[model samples]
Target: MKKLYHNYIDTFRGLSLEVWWLSLITLINRAGTMVIPFLSIYLSDSLNFTLPDVGWIMTFFGLGSVLGTWMGGKLTDKIGYYKVMLVSLLGTGILFVLLQFAKTFEAFCAGIFLVMLVADAFRPAMFVALSAYSKPENKTRSVTLIRLAINLGFSAGPAIGGVIITGIGYQGLFWVDGITCVLAAFLLLKVLHPKKAKILDVVKVENPVSAYKDKAFWIFFIAMFIFGFTFLQYFSTMPLYYKEVRLLTVLEVGLLMGFNGFFIFLFEMPLINWLENMKNSKTKLIAFGLFLVAISFIVLNFTSWVGILIIGMLLMTIGEMIAFPFSNAFAVERAKKGNQGEYMALYAIAFSLSHIFSHNVGMQMVDKYGYEFTWNFITILALLGVFTLFILLKVLKKEKNT
Candidate 1:
């Protein structure tokens, strides 16, 4: 047992201080987003805004993220990832603090929009930096480690936010989120030294715009967008749906989200490795995952019991764990070297856009048609994602033959 423990410690000892710091930064940032899952409740119950109004407010947040992600990628390519991440973290922290004083719905929306803009801008830079700093052999594991950190933080953050909101109210949640962001910025700056790279060093391909011409790339991007359309319900609508319709307590909702993070922490690395070694049929795993997610939602439609909901959430988490990282690996394989930032930016934008549309559409569908309709709608979206994956597999085969 002693030797086994030592070996485990030795494995992590190979990771640099920078990689560790980056993971910490990711955790902090994700912790700040804990309030996001419950934002609809905050807006409707605490602030007295209607459901439709919350949807409109979220549109601004999504718009800001869309622009921020694109600009962040370009800036990382030009000014380097360290600078971009620092700016994003510090700026987002200040915005979070400012949001506390927002009196009107418009003011609250604007504050959150700016916060998401800066916060999301940091994501691409962070991912690019992780890829750049790690050895190629350890790249997948490195990314999974970062994700694990984020999930761990997320697991705790939402539960904490839920408790804080139930105990002290929404303002307390904002304060906690703001403080975490500032601390994350400080830790990142202290640990990650900004290294300036020449334009040539940063821009290896020179023409990142050409990636759009790749058919496989478009298929993957579209599939990811559809996947996001279904997956986003966990953040946007699930909490509100459970609280309002199923009458779950805040603690129960938090516990459900915590379960999601726990599953990812336990299974993500082993799943990634297993999927990577699955011969040449990686896309089949993605299709299977999408099918699982769709089935999970369909099963959810019949359950008002908390136990059943938990089981469905576990299935959804399994699907997410299988699909998300593999999709990223697939994108990287198809991308031109040195243009990863642009490709990932586009991919991230798809997710952001999906969040915007799905939240708005799902909220309206739930209000008009009912929870069953919304679940069915998301199921169809997941199935569409599966169809796109099949198309991508065909495209990959053709590319190989060429």
Candidate 2:
């Protein structure tokens, strides 16, 4: 027992301070940004907006995020990661503060769009920085740790935000989010110094046309696009499903999401390490994860019981943890040496496109076909993701032999 305990401690200690700090920053930032999960609730309950209006507002935020992610990648490459991170954090903080003053629905939507744009823009830059700092062998673990922190923060944030929303209202949520953003930015500025890279030093004004030409890149992007379509349901439609179909209380919904983060925190590191050692290919892991996710949805279709829902959520979270970071690491590994930023940018674009398409299309499908149909649609997408992975594996194998 003592030996096992000490080994566990030593393993944690072996993780770099940079990884720890980045994870901490993610935790703090996500904890404060609780508005994301409850945005539709705030619009409907607090702001008295219609469902369609809320959907439109979400579309704007998605559009803004698309631009933000692309610009963040380009800026990181052109200037430096540290500078882009600082700017994105500070800009998002200012926007969140402005959001507190939004009285009209239009104003609230506009503020949210601006804030989400900047907040999400920070993501690609952060991903690039984390990847750059990690050794190739450790890169996937590092990314998983960061994602675990995000889930931890998310788990706590919504539950806390629920209490705050119940007591003080949406304005309080905005204030808390803004304060956390400012603090996270300050900490990041203090700890992260950008080491100039050769890519940034060189002046290449050419379009990233070559990045789009990589067949593997396009295959990966398409797979992520399919993944995103299913994934976005968590944000846009799942809460409504919980509320309307399952008849869950606000606190109950928050607790369920919190549980998701808790699982990620507890299991992500061990799972990533285990997966790394598994003889199965990364593509197989992804296919397996998607299969689990599809199975979870099938489980979801039959039950409105909270216990069953929680079980399904657990399965989904495990699948997501296995797939997401691996996809990211694969993209980075596949990039041309000097074009890391461009490759990551395109990868980020896949996510943005997924969000836009899913939110807009998924919501409509939910409205028309109901939750069961929506889940069925997502299951089909998950199966398609598996098929894509098979194709990707064959291509990777052919390249390897060559």
Candidate 3:
């Protein structure tokens, strides 16, 4: 028992203080992430938009994200991550407040597009900042640490959001979310102020390759896009399923979603630490994670028992814990050999594109063919992603040997 306790303690050793501060800022920003998780419900329930309309609005959200990441990547390369992050956080905070007032479909679409554009710009900049803050050897663990903070925040956010929805209404979610983003921005400004902090740029390339020119990376990008598409259903359609089929209250649904975050918080770091020691292939682990997520979706089709929801969420959370940090580490490592901002931007864009397609496509599938069919379809797609990852693993190995 003492050995086990020490192992857990050892898992957190050697990270720089800046990484911890970055994680804290991420936690604060994400803790107020009440808006996105419940956006579909808000649009459908409050504004009375049709499913197709909701999907279109979400597509706009993705479009903004895609452009935002691209723009942020270029800006980070040109100006630096500090300025990009400051602008993104402050701008996103203001946008959220204004977005809540947009009632019409057109107005809401524009508002969400602008909001995500500004919000997602933070992603690549954060990755760049993460690279600057941590040593190469600690990359994956540092990513896992950030994920732990994100999950911890996520676990709390939904529960708090549910209560806010119940007590004051959905509008309250916007206010809290906005306030938190602004708070995080100020906190970042105070602590990691560019003048006071000298971040070592760990990733420096003499002649960096563009992300678009990398063939193996594009294959990996596709797998990540599919992975994001499938995993995101937990946030988008799964809540509606909990509400409609399972007859769960909104609060119950929030708690159920929170379970994923809580599970990740508890198990991910130790698991990653153990895996890191094994010196296994990152791509293989990611493929395995994809397989687990595929199983998570298919499990829903096998039973209607309420216990199955917990089982499915557990599978998904474990898959996320296995996949995300390694994927992030891989992207960062690859960027070290190439253009850091460009490579990380492309990585962020893959998930952002998935945001474009996941919510709308899942809703359409569920609406047209029922939830069972949708689950089956997503399962098939996820398996395809797993196969693609195996291909990437082979390709990466070949490149390394050459």
Global lDDT scores for all candidate models:
0.77, 0.78, 0.89
lDDT of 3 by residue, 11-106 (tens): 999887888999999999888879887888999999999988987897888899999999888888889889999999999999998889999999
Superposed model 2: Cα runs more than 4 Å off? 1-13, 166-168, 195-209, 239-254, 301-308, 336-338
**Model 2, clash count?**
0
Where does model 1 exceed 4 Å of error?
Answer: 1-17, 162-169, 194-203, 206-209, 236-253, 279-281, 301-308
In order of lDDT, best first, we have 3, 2, 1
> Candidate 1 on 344-363: residue-level lDDT in tens?
67778889899779877777
lDDT comparing candidate 3 with the true structure: 0.89
Mind giving the per-residue lDDT tens digits that candidate 2 earns over 230-334? 776877688788889999998898688677777777677777777787756777887787777777777888766678888888888888888887887787676
Question: Order of all candidates by TM-score, from best down to worst?
Answer: 3, 2, 1
> What TM-score, to 2 decimals, does candidate 1 have?
0.85
Candidate 2: give its CA RMSD in angstroms.
3.5
Candidate 1 residue pairs in clash (backbone atoms < 3 Å): none
For candidate 1, the per-residue lDDT at 374 reads 87
Question: How many residue pairs clash per model?
Answer: 0, 0, 0
TM-score of each: 0.85, 0.88, 0.91
lDDT of predicted model 2: 0.78
